[model samples]
Target: MIPTNRQITPETPLDSLTLDELDQLLSEKLVTLQVDLLKTYEQQLREHEETLDHLHRHRRAISLPPRPTIGQDDWHSYVYDTRPSREIASVTDLVTINFTNVHTVVDIFPVALDNIHAIYKLDSGNGYILQDDTMHLLTVRNQWTKSPTGCSCPGQASDTRCACCALGSVLCQVSASGVSNTCVEDSQINSHTCSSQSPRSLELDNAIAFEYHTYSEGVQQVVVIAKGENIHFYRLDKWGLQDFHSLKGHNTINLDSPVTHLGYGEMFVEQFGTVTRKRYLFTFGLDSSSKRYYEIVTNPQDFSIETGLSMMWDTTGTSMKVWQNGGRVIIGVQDGTNLNIHELTSDRWGRQQISLQQVLSLPAGVTSWRSYATGFENFLIATTLPLPALYLTVATIDRFLQTQRNIPRNKLQLVGVTAMFIASKYEEMYCPEIGDFAYITDKAYSKAEIRKMEVTMLNELGFNVSYPLPFHFLRRNSKAGSVDASQHTLAKYLMELCLPEYSMCHYKSSIIAASALCLSLKLLDGNNWSDTLTYYSRYTEEQLLPVMCKMASVVVKSSSAKQQAVRQKYKASKLMKISEIPQLKSKLINTLAEKSASYA
Candidate 1:
């Protein structure tokens, strides 16, 4: 919170300020605060989007090389083909994890998937409080996973008292020790008891745990029980479960309270116009609805919730979490087969309005999933707990390898990881420790090796990483083509298809991108390459035809090619499943390739 020139001069007398002057001063400060808020908000938003885009492209070496296809069925007939140079890893994805009968896997706040403490469902309402692979008799929650249990809690809760542990009629009160543990913990299961108020039957759709900092009561743990439109708030202190008045606003200096967090209320008393202010905090979250129902609670005091000003919004969402106290909202919305995730910030001006800041898309189901928030901050610690950390890794490796005429095979793995380390520093939002990067190699390289290599690589490359990438040019050319979502994605797939081919490296990136898009438009039965594309791309149809031929040739061999990473990636529904489109196989492409090749 930097002091601004707008601050009323401390040297000025208080009597000189009038009510109108005070109001004017307050408005200006607020406007300035909001502008600063918006700038910071936009910056974080851009980093998040770039991180996703960075991950979306190549995902670095995070994904295991396509299942190793060289062994097993083809081992007997497989003959090693000698080439000038080849990959350190097999391109074909051979390793796969197979499961049967399970419809949905629910794990809570997992550190990792394979080794997580969770309660999973094996369809038909049969629940397993412990993960099948983890194999533990104990569970964090006391839900009878075996036969028909007394509770048919459909949803899993974050920590100890999950909705799954709740019998359609009772709220489970967990001990404060389980407070920090969201999904499961290795600790003993806490005793569960229903609220003493009788009939004790209330079905729960979702249960969330959050921390609240009160004006008087330092830091308190809070739990929210959301079922349909009805919400219940409970406080979890050392004294155990106590009812909180409806859900008053939580105090946070983070993204939650935008203005005051920046001290907008502290107008100068002497030099600045004097302003007395009463605090009015607001909170908004999904109230409940298949059609996306939400509610905004306005003017709640620090201690108690005010009932009169709750406003509901007509929208759809599956789940939501308030982060930075109440500054921003993270929501999960179901869009067809995919679950769309979004981040929102409250509108600085409006009492009930919130702005959408970020978006994410995930596949229908995953064996293991990790929920992220607070920890996604722009800290220096690498969580590989996984960005430009994608292309930066590529640029580093390409530069290092291209410069070194001869490098040892054993050191190649070290070089690869070292490049990733350098890239993460340059491009990644949150970079892990140098030791953490070393661990990713299964101890093949020591921390000292990675740290030493990092220095060597940076010095050898002269710290230059501004290598132009195909994705960059592809974006401009796609805009020039004025293509639709499918056409643009198909173009991306075509461009990526040529990435593995050694020969394609000879052409300029801009030409390669232009050619891929040009072929995509023609293949889709869309318009021909126009003057705009030629002008922006600086590649005429005849010149592009040659590169376009190479791209088409890569596509023809893509399905059968050893490098299946590009094909497997674009085949997902998220990327519009462009690789599976039929135009890649058409004779028209063969004709174009032959025609282009004939020129040389």
Candidate 2:
């Protein structure tokens, strides 16, 4: 409803007031009430202005790259000189290991080179590797519980996770040496073993490629044979021994497509049809560079792989893929030139296709780095990781928002919260609710205080929530036909790859901004050369391109000096040279474009 600029008298009743009259009264009351709101917002604006001013004032002195990466010393000191066996310790081994399927925990393993004996997928969303050295399952949870067999032989026993609490099942390990799939049940101390119908098959060279399966709420058990290119399902349930399904084999020597192996959990396996019999089967393929998703309609009577929908990604020069979020499916359709998102709804045959027009609705820009993680409240969150420098900038802005007046607390919280969400994308599967943030805040902030801050922040920032800056560069730089012929090449490259929505700048300026931002962050905080390059390497460098990486470092340092000079010489004019900022943004875009065009 539109508000009126009229005054109201005290005689107006609460319900008797007309819509117009109510609006007028509400407007008047708002003016009166907002005296505090205005002041708060104004204070916040001033703080934001001051921070910008301070940053400008000290811009020359500010360092480009942060020094001393986190955990540098600890990382270097923890040397792995000996090769540890990757075999899972037997049930008789006296040790316990924490197990989980969480992705964040994947990077926390102290021993990377050590062989993983068994990979355990828990009902809880986390994956863990069985280790022989410590004999303890390590997880991101930071704690481990001893299995019944290993309870007495624990090396570190701060806390033990009760076996009963576990889902009470382990992935059947099949090796050439032939090991039994028996493990102690959570409720029962005795071991329950599943026999191997075929004496251990070492058909596959890579153990990591092997997958585990079990169905029937444990009534029917099925072990998936992931050896070779084709998948073969073996029924391990009381159905005795029988080959439930065997995929048409493909000889690796006659490779046809870039075959990628994707993982599925219990829920996905359940969706494969029903507990009683097999339900659905499908495979995904890519056309040179574009991603195509295909689903096969399976008939339990006679298993068949049906040819489902085939889709061609709209944009050129992109690395595209699909990911499932909780119940919903998310398709990552990178144009290689621009970023696009499409929601897929399947037909009766499971044929799914997305329209080009609908692709326009997503958050614009070529994504630099994106990941889905499970949030605290089981909500799924897609996040973008920030460079260290950008994080510092955000920190500075947050500080300003907190202390400034005229800004609502919610406003400031919005910025920090959104950034937090973006950063979490590369790590977690989900993002927590806004209320979750509020709940956590109680440990440090009061509700009223937060509300006040939010209001002030919204007012100060002019309520701008769009941060398509990264995408802008991606689109321009990543376009399929883009060429690196001008200063704007980098920007074009960014637009091509990132597909960032346009804001107020040219494609070139956008490229400069994104590249500078990323470069600055890496300089300030990245540990190794590879970590520093990250997305930038897609366009600017090759696999482990040390020389290109070094060039990026030089580019950032040179640009920092140039920007500093501009700040000093022009002082008032913020004009700066384009060369100072690294051109990774452009390079990435052009690279994707070339890649796309090649396929086209």
Candidate 3:
């Protein structure tokens, strides 16, 4: 343990210092010493509170129960009454979902009579869930599929069969009435026909990709680009396929283009009015050179990209950042670790690029990010773990367990707990407490149980998160031999940053938080933040810039001042009442000894 000089005692020269001076002194110490920033700073308090010792006792009380298995079925049956009994389950407001976190929300929608699937919302109503082909429409009160086979009548029924066209495809569009959308499928396909194949089999040989949007005015539109590069924009209504407009830009998105990932910018209110954010469709895929681009689509007269920033690349992926003073077309990327920036500008044609730039570099690759809203003032959130690092950590854990045959299962639990604890401090803005996990475990754990599990997990895995971007940055800068240098440093910092709240499941938040911190350090001190960014993909200055500025001025300064005063008062006013601070500690030790002897 590092030695810290004690400024407050039973008696000292306290009368001379003003409140502000005392606060300033305390703030400096806390920043330098790194105390638990969020929690109350209590030096002398009650001890041996077994209830407090356990972290998760309260969790099970609040959270929903877990499920045994989540059946693989299209979600259509749940909301679709036309489907057979086997496809649906009774509705209940409380659902114990399988393989889903407690904080996540799942929505069921109708797609087709026979098939349906659910998707997690990434941004709006967002979370991550498996992909499906059917589109859920509450307006139509129906689920529709892209394949005609999905709509086959109950049992290959003849009357419901479409006789004109044998093509096994389906297309849906809204009518001019603007009330409901209609599904159009080949007339030859029967509702009851069943094939030996699974539903998700995509015919990549010929397929088109599209996007959907819902406006605040309740106007919904789906844009489909077809085989001949024809663009079809449909506004969903009661009749079908109304106000058809064909465009030429469909061909511009070539299959041969190097990029693969596709993203759409969300609509947000700007200083002028509601602005249509551009859609970002690009990729880290290697069939083409690593490239990135943004397609800005708004009323051409209203908004556009104005200028270019800067760009840089590392190992995991590439990233770009852009900003306009009161504009809402904010875009960020992290294929892995490469970073870029772009500005929204309205050119002469009212087309936006408007110009893009690459601004900073991070040590790790970035995967995803979330920016806090105006009031709360917190860090930019991002997740930055690559497959390889996870594998490495898993391997390390396996070997440790294999070698330490004498270690009990309880000890192994501690290792897992510690690894999660460390990861949380590295990633999330609001780290879950040890009590949170204990509560989730339904009071089936003890301090010994948690600590042992944490140690075992660490000994086995080394570090929970490991990735490549740091190596790329190091290699480019000639600091160390490879990315391993960054990994080694990350491993150390991750361990040092461990907090009481980390858990196995909430690792994503930790990954994001660490990435943000890494990026901040990169800008502030020019350290190996890119490596952190690579492992945690969500770190970007555009998202983090405001929060970092606030921390220096408000949070850090105020917290230090308050905590220092609390400690000083407690030491002088309270500490004198007792001979020593460790009196309760001894009592707890004695109690543990007696309990152990009784058990033996």
TM-scores across all candidates?
0.38, 0.27, 0.29
Candidate 3 per-residue lDDT over residues 1-600, each given as its tens digit: 112544455465767566865786667566544433211222221221233323323743566544323221111110101110112121135344344332432222111111212223211232222334323321111123322222334334542332111234343322232221123334523433212111221111111122333333333333222112222222233322122222312213333423323323322222122233334332223333333433434222211122122222222333332222222234444442333433334433334443443333332333333333222111234433332333333333444555667866755555444444545444444444554344223224644566566665555556544433222332332232233433334332222122121222123333434432443344333565454454344445454343323222221232245222222222322124111233212443244324433322
lDDT for each residue of candidate 2 in 1-600, tens digit (9 for 90 to 100)? 433554346864678667877776677676566455544654665565456545644863665444232211111110000110111111122243443423222121111122433434322323344444432332211001112222211232432322211244342323333232233333433322323222232232111221222242322332332233444343332212233322422111212443222222111221112112112222222334223433323333332223334444333323333333333344444442133444445343334444442231112122232322323111112222223323332433544444564655655555554444433332233333333333322213433444564555556655553344443443444343232233233332222222222221232334444453333333333323233334543434233233223334333333344223211211111213232344334564234334432322
TM-score of 3: 0.29
lDDT (0-100) at residue 539 of candidate 2? Answer: 37
- The TM-score measured for candidate 2 stands at 0.27
Q: In model 2, how large is the Cα lDDT of residue 507?
A: 28
lDDT of 1 by residue, 448-488 (tens): 78879888888898878677777788887777667899888
| Models, CA RMSD each | 21.2, 25.7, 26.5
